[model samples]
Target: MTDKPNESSEPTPPRTQPVVSGQAAPSPYDSPTGEIPVVKSGAGENVPRTEDELGLDPEVPGVGERTEPIANRPAEEPTEPVTPAYAFASIPPAPAAGEGGLRRRGDYRRGTLDLGLLGLRLVVGLTFLYHGLQKLAGWFHGPGLDQTRAMLEQGGWKHGELSTAMLSVAEVGGGALIVLGLATPLAAGAVLASITDAWLWKQGMAPGFQYKPVELESILVGLAATLILTGPGRLSFDRNRGWATRPMWGSVTALVLALIAAAASWIYLHGGNPFTGFFD
Candidate 1:
């Protein structure tokens, strides 16, 4: 008999299957909708397997891990710092009585200035009116222009008649205008001219302290200058006509003009006069 074949030592033949169109073999990780199956190791092993173990993103932390819902994050809001309501309020009170007293004193000084200006105006007006009337009417021992010219001729004026007439006109006309506070600068200028003339011509011979005629006139001129510089106080027609609120620069102009006029008068009267040398 032929040697019996060793059935236990026989080699197994390879099996083959036909390929199907449009179909794939099911994967070990395949699952139905809405569920993921957990993978495990071979039998009797305790090790767990995850998608990450197969080099895939793990869904254990939940799906769409990178695309977090904005609602779950903390919100941001723009806020401004709160400030005290009275931080920018008015200035606080001064701590010293001296400051308060100084403020009050300043107010009082302003009031006094106003009152002094008013008084000066009234006195100048009355005095001018009186002298003007005396010269115009030859009243109260006032000499007529002809008599004044004769007197001035004896005192060394070359053109006595013209000088006397001009003096009378300035005195009367300027006085009336000053009293009315109309064209006050012109009036003051006229008065200044007359006073300057008296000081240079007639009064120069008189003793310094004797009943010097020009002394009163000089004072009057100074007062008139003050009025011209400051303008007629609130009681005058200048104020009523809205002409008295002159700029401060006008005072400078007035002062400059007055100084020039004064210099010119002095030069004209005394520059060539031999008599001025005697006094000098």
Candidate 2:
């Protein structure tokens, strides 16, 4: 019968059908699309897989809950990085200060700026008050009304009596108002005009920063201008009456009015022209 088949080459046995209660089980479902369904372990579906079984680290660095293979997992939409719950335990960061780290509210209160303005007001206001008293009644070792009148006439004041009286009233009344912080704008304007008028008289046709030593008129003018710009502090009558903290427009108007009054007073006293005295 020719060469006989070797024992090692004997025919392999075929797979037998699995039986369930004496009936044959059906074959696995074969979809037209050929997609394979998920498989589970034989121990049970609810049981968790340990690290030994999965061959992965027990404490992976950036991993969260729901341990599944990345390839098998469904893709998720991207979102912003989430802060952990424990991150809240740390203190929150502080906010940065604005605008060159300055806190210039410029309010009419007893704060840093208010106190400074108060001090300045007292100094200038009291000084002017003393001068006013001196011109009015010869107090503070200054010339009296008669001498003031004589000085006015000598300084080219045509209507000496009228000019002298106006200056006296302006100084005395404006000084009082400034000291009390009442009608601050009005007080500042009046005082500023009076200082400018005196400046003209004192210069007496001199030109440009000539006389040194004290420079009383220049100092008074600066102080009065500051008041016009800064307004009275919270400690003044104006603050109490809601007239303090006037805007920039108000300050500009006050300065303009003061200059106009000063020019008028100068022309009235000089009779001819106050401009001529300012130049050579």
Report the lDDT of model 2 for residue 77. Answer: 86
User: Please, what are the lDDT tens digits per residue for candidate 1 over residues 32-147?
Assistant: 56465555567855454656555554434555566545589778788898865686779885678777777756634444554565577667766766665666577778776667
Q: Give the Å error, residue 159, model 2.
A: 0.9
Q: Which portions of model 1 show Cα errors greater than 4 Å?
A: 1-115, 207-214, 240-247, 262-280
Residue 129 miss distance in model 2 (angstroms):
1.2
Please write out the lDDT profile of model 2 over residues 115-171, one tens digit for every residue. Answer: 777777787778778888898899989898899989878767788788778888888
lDDT of 2 at 17: 72
Worst 10 residues of 1 by lDDT: 269-278
Q: Which segments of model 2 are wrong by more than 4 Å? A: 1-110, 205-214, 240-243, 271-280
**Per-candidate local distance difference test:** 0.64, 0.76
